[model samples]
Each structure stands twice: as structure tokens, then as C-alpha cells.
Target: MALQIGDTAPTFSMVDSDGTLVDLSALKGTKVVLYFYPKDDTPGCTAQACNLNENLDYLSSKGYRVIGVSVDSNAAHTKFKKKYNLNFSLLADTEHELVNKYHVWVEKSMYGKTYMGTARTTFLIDENGIITDIISKVDTKNHSSQIH
Candidate 1:
């Protein structure tokens, strides 16, 4: 089933690029901007990540913490973060756990070829863990503005 606003966000515990454990259940009292992207360092993903990073302070001021999820390895996430000086946590969902749980993994079509990939999606979860908004068509360049 597709996740919708007011549904409880799926809980996850995964290691981030910095090797720090990020557990969703542990962040109960904090609002979260949970985003799923295709891959680390890709053009669109990079733009989205950088845009969010650049506007992180504004998002933080609104009491939201950003967390990015991808099926990339921790090493790849580390390199991507270092390359862009990203300040938010990039969770390495190498096992496809988070992607499947969040239902972002889907069949995609490009150039007449069909393949499985992570759909660019964002879930805005409130302090109590209930999803407040779902951004299916994300604007990579102005993502933060779309969040509010």
C-alpha cells in the first residue's frame, strides 16, 4: 500500500555515511524530512542533496531534521558527502530494507527500458511520527521550498 499523510512513518535503524546509527524510533520527538533518492553522486540526486544541505539551516529552524536514504554503500555515501560537504545524514540502505519498507523501490521506465530503482520521494513526518506530507514529484533544485 502507498504511504499517505497521517500514516505512521516506518521505523528504521541504519548506519549513516559517518558510521553513526540513525534510528527512526529514537527520533520520536523530532520532525523529520526523510528523502529517498536514486543514487549518490548522480546529477539529479546531487542537486537535490546540495539544495537540501544549503537550506538545512532553514529547515532546522522549522524543527525538521533531514535524512537521506539510498541503496548505495556507506563508502559511496561517505564520498558523496565529502564531495559536497553535505551536513545531513545519508543512510546507506544497502540491503534495500528501508526502500522496501518505505515502498520507494519501484519499476521505472527510461529509454524504453524497464528496471527497478528508487523513486525520488520525500516524507515529512511530524514530531509524533505521523507523516504530515508526501512529496512525490520532488523539485531537485528547490526541494526545501517544496517541503513547507
Candidate 2:
């Protein structure tokens, strides 16, 4: 079942681009913006990440830490981050563990070809680890405003 707004955010341990282990449970007492995207460096994904990167201070000011998740490998995430200068952590869900745990991995369609992929979604979790909101239809360019 899809996670509901009042549901507790699933705890996960994933590796970031720098090979640092990031455990969601460790981020207690901080609001989290966990976004799942299809791929790193893609047009829409890049736009979304850049928007969040540009608004990192605003998010932090609101006591929110942003984490982007994708099935891309850490090397790909490193390249994307370096290329775009993204200022937030990008979790490498290469094994689809976190994505599946969050239920973002599902069947997707592109050009009428159905295949498994990451659905662009964002979960806003409060300090207590409760989900406050879920953005299923993300606006890539105006994402920060959407969250704020």
C-alpha cells in the first residue's frame, strides 16, 4: 500500500555520493524532504534538483534537510552533483532498497513502453518522522515554492 500522510516515514540506510552511510533514523529532530526521481542528470530531474539546490538555504531556514533518491549509482550521482553543483545529499538507491521501501519503484510508461522505474515523488516528513505531505505531481521549476 502507498504510504499515507499520517504514516511514519520508513527508516532507511543508504549510501550517499561520497559513500557515506545516511540513515534516516539518525535525522531525528529535523524535517526531511525526501524526493525520489527517475534518474540523475535527466532534464526534469536536473531541473528539480537545481531548483532544490538553489533553494537550499530557504529549506534549511525552514528546518528541512533535502535528500534526493534515485536508482543511479554513487558514481553517477557524484558526476551529476559535480556537474550541477547540487548542494544536497543524493542517495544512491542502486539496489532499489530504499525506493522499494518508500514504494517509489513501480511500473512506468514512456513513449507507450511500460517498464519499471522510479516515480517522481516527494515526501515531507516532520521532525518526529511522520509524513506531513506527499507530492505526487511535482513541479520541477517551482518545487521550492511548492514545499514552502
Candidate 3:
């Protein structure tokens, strides 16, 4: 079943670009902007990540800790983060555990070719871990406005 507002966000323990462990359960007291992207360094994904990074301080002022998730490896995330100077955690979900749990991994079509990939979705999780909103139609360049 798809997750909805009021549903408790699934807890996850994944390593970030720096190989540091990030556990969802450890973020209980702060709001979370858990965003899933298809790939690192892709145009749309890059725009979204950069926009979020640019507005990170504003979002943080509202108590939202942004965390980007993708099936990319830690090495890819590190390079991407450095290239963009991203100031947030990019969780390496190479095993697809987080995507599957969040139900963002789905069939995708491009150039008439069908494949499985991550959907660009953002979950607004409240301080207590309950999902307050889900942004399925993300505006890559202005995502921070959509969240905050």
C-alpha cells in the first residue's frame, strides 16, 4: 500500500555520502524532508538537489532537515555533493531498501523503453515521524517553495 499522510514514516539506517550512519529514528524531534530522486548528477535531480541546498538555511529555520535518497553508491553521492557543494545528507540506497519501503521504486518509461527506477517524491515528515504531506509533482528548480 502507498504511504499517506498520518502514516508513520518508516525508519531506516543508511550511510550518507561521508559513510556516516543516518538513522531515521534518530531524527525524531525535527521535521524531515525525505526526498527520493532517480539518479545522482542527472539534470532534473541536480536541479532539485541544488535548489534544496540553496534554500537549506531557510528550511532549517523552519525545522526541516533535508535528506536526499537515491540508489546511487556512496562514491557517486560524494562526487555529486562536492560538485554542487550540497549541505545535506545524501543517503546511499544502493540496496533499494529505502525506495522499496517508501514505494518510490516503480516502472518508468523513457524513449519507449521500460525500466524500473526511483520516482522523484518528497515526504514531509513531522517531528513525531508522521508523514504530513507527499509531493509527487516536484518542481525541480523551485522545490524549496513546495516544501516550505
TM for every model, in the order presented, reads 0.98, 0.97, 0.98
Q: Rank the candidates by lDDT, best first.
A: 3, 1, 2
Clashes of 1: 0
Mark the regions of model 2 whose C-alpha exceeds 4 Å error after superposition: none
- Stronger candidate by lDDT (2 vs 3): 3
Residue pairs in collision within model 2: none
- Give candidate 3 misplaced runs (Cα > 4 Å): none
> What tens-digit string does per-residue lDDT give for candidate 1 at 1-148?
9898999999988778898889999999999999999999989999999999999999999999999999999899999999999999999888899899999999999999999999999999999999999999999999999987
Please list all clashing residue pairs in model 1, or write none if there are none: none
* All models, RMSD in angstroms: 0.6, 0.8, 0.7
For candidate 3, the lDDT comes to 0.95
RMSD of 1: 0.6
Q: Locate the minimum summed-lDDT window of 10 residues in model 3.
A: 13-22
lDDT of 3 by residue, 73-148 (tens): 9999999999999999999888999999999999999999999999999999999999999999999999999985
TM value for model 3: 0.98
